[model samples]
Target: MPAQPFTALAIGEAIRRGELDPVALTRQCLTRATDSDAVFISLTEQRALVEAEACAQRQRSGTLRGPLDGVPLAWKDLFDIAGTATTAGGKVLGKTPAERDAEAVRHTAGAGMVCIGKTNLTEIAYSGLGLNPHYGTPHHTPPPTSSEHEHESRNENEPRAPGGSSSGSAVAVAQGIVPAAIGTDTAGSLRVPAAFNGLVSYRPSQARHSRLGVTPLADSLDTIGVIASTLEDCLAIDDTMRGSAPLVRAAAVPEQSVIVLDAGCLDDPRVSRAVGDNLEACASRLKDAGFHIVRRRVASVADTLEAITRHGWLGAAEAYTEYRALLEGPDAEAMDPRVRKRLEAARQMPPDSVVSLYRLRQALKTRLREELAGATLLTPTVAHVAPLLAPLEADPEHFSEVNLATLRLSMVASLLDSPAVALPSGRDDDRQHTSLQLSGPCGEDEALLRVALGASSALTA
Candidate 1:
């Protein structure tokens, strides 16, 4: 029989039509995981196969749940999976298992998606660069040339940063180990990796999904997100996560004014010429599609960075709050030094200053909404393509520098509490991927997805 398709929707459709068996599909993905097992902290092999068998039975009974029914996906290790240890990419979590699935995980499973495993992430999901000194970091593995189970003799590409804190989840989809995976975005965890690995990542408005079972980075800024190969897949999987189809408007005229920040935002020295060209080409294509492109200095972007500098980063402050006892206890010695340092910095923040920062953040959000108007904003998801892994592993200082730079643009959307999608922007000189991000007003996720759907063809053209 011919090899089954790789995307979730396609695979689900095949299963629904009896062209593919869910059990067989699950086995194929499990086999793929074997070669890149470093991507996962734990594989729910027995559980997944059992789930797949039931899904296969459901398909035969004409009761497949939905487009995601029987489809296998990986989750970032931060999410609670009943009976599995929720590591949050840290060594200090020990062996305690979660009694119930994360609300996000429950929602996805309820929609009939099978959980193959929990993918690795940056330690505590703290960094944009997907380095995990505790759990092994997952790198970008090239796709199989033939079947989903094809194993190559040798990998010619040098290992590069996977883009974290959703590193493994992004790699799983990018390498075709799975069709799609769930990731979390606090600042730029989802979007940065999507940019580095050539996948589409969606960051919903902060309040769109419940955060009950996922490990917290910053309660106020954290949001559940999905990384997939296409916008449509993201929409489908996002629907499953949200427990209903998004409130997407039909036949809504595409917004014509595409807002762009000044060249300074896109001209970072880390950005490659190819990435710059690809971004320009996407803008030009959108302009040809009748969208009027406008360029300006978005003062809000600057204001966000200033706020972080003045009041200390909310992510750091909140993360410190969540992990204070742990960091202060003896187990703190086991924590990733990089993450420990960040939380320590935030620990020093004055209680009153953190409170004041929240007020400033509220004001900034309102000011940005008015300044941006209805024009959707566009920017490169990261300043550079994924960096070589060796140097980053060897130097903590270098890792911190690159990690912060990788997050510069995507963090803007997070600060504004806006919905954003990062779309692949072709390849850079090293053949590594880069991405362009489309950001819309706060709480307008579906609207942004619709705009992205309309503009996707041009962006990918």
Candidate 2:
């Protein structure tokens, strides 16, 4: 039989049919996880094998847990795994291991998913660019060296950014080391990385998943999300995490308008023509798929940006509140400078500013919902494809500029409390990936996921 695609649903089905042994699958994933660039910060090989052995036994007894049973996955290092340090991709955290698995981890484990290891991330899940000074950034594992041929714009040797705070999680899946992984999307951490790596990522409604035992970034803005190769896989992981019933057939695509925002940022010089073209292609596909595509300018989007500019981001304020002690403590010197700088800046903002921004954000969310009522909003997940890692790391100014620009579109969804999914559109001129994001009204995640599944197929096709 042909090898199944590297996805939870595929692997688990094989395990259930007794065609694949769970212990053997666990070993394979562990081997690949170690070989897949710098994706994993730590590997739970022994425990994973033990769990897989049990899963295999259960399969023999006709006690299969679910679609994810016996599947291997990596967790972003920020999640607390029992007896492991929750590093948050920073050096400052002490060596004390967590007492138990994070709530989400426990949920998945209970559903029989094997935990392969802890994946790396941007320090404290702070940046979208995924460059981490402490835990080295995980890049797309460069294609093997070959003397066969070479192209001018392409060097098979140079590594590209994997999209961040959830950098390692994306790399793990993209490299075929795992079927899926968990990530936090405070401001596009999950979506940006998924876009850069050419994978499926779903940012559920903020209130959908429990945040307990997960390291906080921006408590209010932060959301639990999954990165996988397909929306079905993401839905499976999400369903397991939420302890929901088996996923039913996705609802048929709704015949509603999709608002495509074309503003300065969308047309900004930083956005490559190829990226813009991909966005257009995605819009064209959606229109061809029987959905009305409306080109419109939303003033509330400007309001969202203005609020961020006038008052520091709500995430920045909230993250500062959560990590201020560590930032100001004696171990402060050990923190990543890039992350430290941002947190320090947020610390300087007045408490009243955060309060005012929160109010403004709420009002803007209301305005955006009203403006986009009965329709979904679409945008390029990021301005450009995965950037070369070296140049950005060499220049902090450029890093900061690109980082903010990359977050420009996805951050809007976060600000408005919308549930969004970043679906791969296609590859660009450099053969790097780009994605189109579909963000719907809050609490409408299920419906949006269904629409996205259809749109993703059409856009990619």
Candidate 3:
């Protein structure tokens, strides 16, 4: 009878108290999603209602599976949901309904979470900008109370990039259609969208979770992750997907050391004044909160960038290999032209260069791990806030430039196989959300997440 709680954990708590019906909550989410455009590739109404009913029965009988049981979530279309087409934001892929759920989906279902639907993404999850010419792009509509002054200065209807390849996942949560969503990050898919939409995203080390049944862009770099409204929600979904009970909560802000990378370390000219200032302010807040803040350059960070500059993206070369058949086949005509161009460009990378990049990545991973021994590294999630969509959509060159810039910072974590969390720091002068990323050594996901909880609290406070 009352309005449904807005977060997954809160909804689960209400259900536990016999204060909310999972069936009613599912229907409410379905209704909201049905009215949205370009956010969902397809709705799993029958499946969601069925799952919610079972969860309700479990709660009634005192057989609840976990804390997130009965919570609704959207999966990026790259993940296979039995009986739903896994479009991967392409006109050509997943024409037939998948026969089974992705490994992550199966785990979440095992925890009793409901699948509301599949959200749109960059075609083949290739671009940083969440544009899907085939499915349309989902724009982030700033909440009315977000910033009244900024709303009056600019057209509220002006289209901006939603950050992709998890574009719709972020927007779906931002619009309050669902509490959380599953997405993948090869370079920066999950974090970029979260940054743009003012949400939290966690990209775990590639080895921390199962990737089975999920579509792959680059088997080497692709990682499945969660996008949600808070760091706690991200952690809960992460635990469920890993087949663990949701036991991790934002614990006491642990006394930890945090390394703030020098702004000059990025070597990216596109890094904006607003982003830099906000990152510094966040560092100041953390320092004030008793975090040992060390400001210096990380050699591994510089080395990784140099390797990328010399060899190009290792993922691009791998992606070309994964989809060469489709890219060369006649069906390639159906692919987005921008995506096609980027994939084709990888063809120019020599075989030896790809191998060298792989070797460099392994070496850098070790270097990064040794550099941060239980300490967290903080950096800007992206060099800038979401850019206006119209200009980028209208020019392929501009699109490519912005896409590379958007992914610059996130690629560092991917290459190092490090676990990272992107948290909304504050709004820019334009009132666009700016984000700060906290990352740590590879395979140190839990530790980094704990540190992030503390960092997030300090920054938001």
**lDDT against the true structure, each candidate:** 0.81, 0.82, 0.88
lDDT of 2 by residue, 392-438 (tens): 89988888888888887788889878899998877765567878788
Q: How accurate is candidate 3 locally (lDDT)?
A: 0.88
Put the candidates in TM-score order, highest first: 3, 2, 1
**Model 2: worst 10 consecutive residues (lDDT sum):** 143-152
TM-scores for the candidates: 0.92, 0.94, 0.96
Residue ranges of candidate 2 with Cα displaced over 4 Å: 1-5, 141-157, 254-265
The reply for model 3, stretches above 4 Å from the true place, is 1-5, 146-151, 155-157, 249-254, 265-268
Instruction: Order candidates by lDDT, high to low.
Output: 3, 2, 1
List the lowest-lDDT window of 10 residues for candidate 1: 245-254
Global local distance difference test of model 2? 0.82
- Residue 386, candidate 2: Cα error in Å is 1.3
Of the candidates shown, which would achieve the greatest TM-score relative to the real structure? Answer: 3
Name the lDDT value of residue 166 in candidate 2.
96
